[model samples]
Target: MKHPRLFLHVQEPALAAQLLQSAVVKRFIVVKSSDAAPWSEQLLQQSCDLAFIQADQHSEADYQQLLSSNILAEMDFIFVSDGNPEPWLDKLMRSGAGYHFRQPLDMVCILDTLQDFYQQLSSTQQQVKANNSMLDQFGLLVGSSRSMLKLYRTLRKVAVTEANILIVGESGAGKELVANTVHLASYRAEQPFIAINCGALSPELVDSELFGHTKGAFTGALRDHQGVFAQAEGGTLFLDEVTEMPIEQQVKLLRVLESGEYRPVGSDKCRQANVRIVAATNRDPQQAISDGLLREDLYFRLAQFPVVVPPLRDRNDDIVGLAQHFLAYRNAQEQQQKQLSTATLQLIAEHRWPGNVRELKHAVERAYILADKMIEPDHLLLEMALADTTETELNEVPAGVPLEQLEKAAILNTLEQNAGNKTDSAQQLGISVKTLYNKLEKYQQTEP
Candidate 1:
């Protein structure tokens, strides 16, 4: 999930600095505004999840304009005051305000307020998922849920444009499939579509891999090789888990995006790039920027159009259809046909599917291999009931436990459950393997 963006319009420099230093503030992507520039302009450009406005400093006209604006209709607002409540409070009573905080702010209270805000926001998002007619498949993508249909509509609109795109979703939500759909739908369909996993490559080799290298560029460079950018010229380059890109490589990529030209690792001459970029990441893009994992400039450049793929659990209605599709595809490949029983289909739908669509595909394939003719519930080889119970157990925690500690425990437990396989654990956790490795590294440093 991407971190929520909060706009800070506080006028007092000292108070702004104090809030900026708070640990809880780090959890959000904050956009701080200067007193000189109009905060409304910032609000217009960025879709903020929350806003912290100083009620005392702003004029009545400013408050009235804000109240009339559509920004208040969508995002949550929290009013900040140094002392007693202002008389302007009467006008904002009708606004969908979240909370009010007075000066000498209690960090604990602020943290608690944010936790509740996020919980409410999550619930609201789930409820707002669009409802549409079912679809078994769209291009190569699967799922008939409302979310899938909405995504298809978005793809149709975005594919026609030459604009760069950013695909955000949990692991195994088929981000690659979405990228493929975009490439096929675009004007560059005749050109090659090259896909690269940014997280899987070594940091030292990233530059060479993306921009090509001359012969003897490095110790092992025996021959000249074309990189992804050159190979994908006049086509589309899909960058998966782009947030895992090395910081230095990010600078190079930013230059390419800005100027449409790049130099090879060893060469002085620069080559022009005609390829389109379609990047994907399992982590929240805004959070990645806030955490210093991704460059802010690069994020703004790539995310010209952002499409978020819905997870399998959120599309429960499509589980059976997807399972059957996988089973049929498997049978076609091996020349052995099988059918799933009604009870087995029910069992598949009931499962939480923590690993999303990829997990479901694997489970279905396993059942197809194990079964002779009719696939039963046990043949599916999925622990539906136990997993459902475990899901609940995982969500609950004892009081006074810090959020970071719980997150670490979840990561460690998931890693152990996967037998220390970083890839599997990351998939189950809906994050990238690189992110999992980073967390492990942090834990290692902190261990006493």
Candidate 2:
């Protein structure tokens, strides 16, 4: 909010100059790339607020470059054009641009489109006057790391839209929490936010679970039942582990998503599905699609606004802070003065939380329960400590394995260390037994 910075990367020099020189845009700290080169690290570190880029092949190339450069996720681009909304509109939207304004360079119109954005920035600056505040910065999530900040930018853009959102993250990365925050930030906040785990549902009852079943549809259908779609009418339906849904049910779900109409089991009448969908998966979606776990069409429909939640390992900067937050929360809840010992803090900071935030939170809670005044590292029961103290094998990956393969290898090795005891394996890995089972099941299906 400190003199809102706006970068103009329009293809036309005159249009860029016109927008730059306009009195209406004078309130912004307008910056044009001196040589109109690709955005450098220094420029992004300074945090550009708004960007106007020409919607053409050149801009598309530049946009892809920014994406490859890892800066696209942190940016909010407003594609500008001198013509109709053809050819590039779909491409732009798919690339995450929320607005595509036809240009002859209308300054007043630009201001109108950005009025809310400006005020929102000002409001956020005022509310988060210190180092940062969690709720003010991002919905329900704590941290000011670059990845979290990138996530916040994505959330703010997509939350207001009616499109279905697909949240991708590793297990325990808090996908459901992210989905809940998106729901709370949206217009449907006051309405019911129903959640269902597609993987947990009985495969035979999957359809009924999603679209409800009429009376006498099955042996247990004593009366007509409302499924998640009906239960979340006019609100959001959060579909956790969506990739695990039966293929047949995925077909039904995709039909409903595309047509907005669904017929209940054993019912002739079609019901309107007035529900927003927010789905999440722990798997690599492309891998799932390749393995026939998730339908590509359905994935496309669900991922109108795809949100990638950063793994805990990727958010190293927020590790200790998040642990402290959990400790403080527990202290508040139990009316006790408990604190983490310095050594414990170091352990929390160094260990790679493969189980992500959920693991960290659980570790802190376990420590809180085990300790009196000062929580020590032993209270954490972390895998690293077990490996150091016992003959437990380290989570070693092959020299050239893909990044996605590391977690699976770690899980298998842990399960072996615990003598195939699922619960013990899951505990050692800092994940739920269910998550461990799910990963195992998924792996079992893929082995040749």
TM-score of each: 0.59, 0.68
Candidate 2 wrongly placed segments (more than 4 Å): 1-30, 33-49, 52-73, 77-137, 384-448
Model number with the top TM-score: 2
Q: In candidate 1, what are the lDDT values of residues 76-187, reduced to their tens digit?
A: 6777778765655555643434467887777578767766555434322232222221234555676656577556646755676788999998866788889989999888
Model 2 whole-model lDDT (C-alpha atoms): 0.73
Across residues 1-448, which tens digit of lDDT does each residue of candidate 2 receive?
Answer: 3466777666577777766676656777777665644543334555687776676644445555455554555667777776764544554465555687775667677767666455444423322322322323466667656587667778876787788999999877878779888999988999999988776677788888888899999898999999889999999999988988888779889999999999889899999999999999988999999999999999999997788999888887678878887777778777998988999999999988777776777678656655679998877767543345453332231245565565765575464345335567788889986687677657544521
TM-score of 2: 0.68
Error of 1 at 203 (Å): 0.9
> Which candidate has the top score in lDDT?
1
